[model samples]
Target: MTTDPLSATFAALADPTRRAMLARLAEGEATVNELAEPFSISLQAISRHVKVLEQAGLITRSRDAQRRPCTLRLAPLDDAVDWLEEHRQVLEGRLDRLEVHLRTIQQKNQEHDQ
Candidate 1:
């Protein structure tokens, strides 16, 4: 199946494990073993999660001697935030318009009563 970058990003983020890994990487880069330490899952499993994050452009793994440390990439997240903020502004504008319309109706009713 085909998907856009946004969809891919959301799909990658859908897993709690992946999200936690990203959260950990937020502080600093960590090796696969370091990321797996808090979880009961196998190192292989953590590696798979890291792969997903890497594919989604959410993280990057760099070579540090024999260890590969994963670092969080904020560009994809910033894009997601921009998309959400745009939609939020649309909703806010709609709500503001609704509020004005309601006030106009209330005023008309008050005038009719008087």
Candidate 2:
């Protein structure tokens, strides 16, 4: 089954290797061999990770002669960030309300005790 864009972006980012790859790409474009250099995994594995990032719209791979370099595409990351920021604001508002209610209850208890 097909997944939503946000879900796909999250799923691709769930892996540490994929996340690292994205970080590397953030610095600049890198070939599969270049991405695989820091890891002990085979080039094939790195290529697979690249494919997932590409599918998630987090990166784009372009051919430059024999080399296929992967570049970061920030739109998906921006979307994810927007989603997280929206939820954070909602949660923060809930916490603020809860704190107000708790303080009010505490004041009432103090008055009753007095």
Pairs of residues clashing in candidate 2: none
Expressed as tens digits, the lDDT of each residue in 41-108 for candidate 2 is 88888888888998999999899999888899999999999999999999999999999999999999
Per-residue lDDT of candidate 1, residues 12-65 (tens digit): 999999999999999999988899999999888988999889989999988978
Q: So what's the TM-score on candidate 1?
A: 0.83
Clashes of 1: 0
What ranges in model 2 sit over 4 Å off?
none
* Deviation in Å, model 2, residue 20 alpha carbon: 0.8
Q: TM per model?
A: 0.83, 0.94
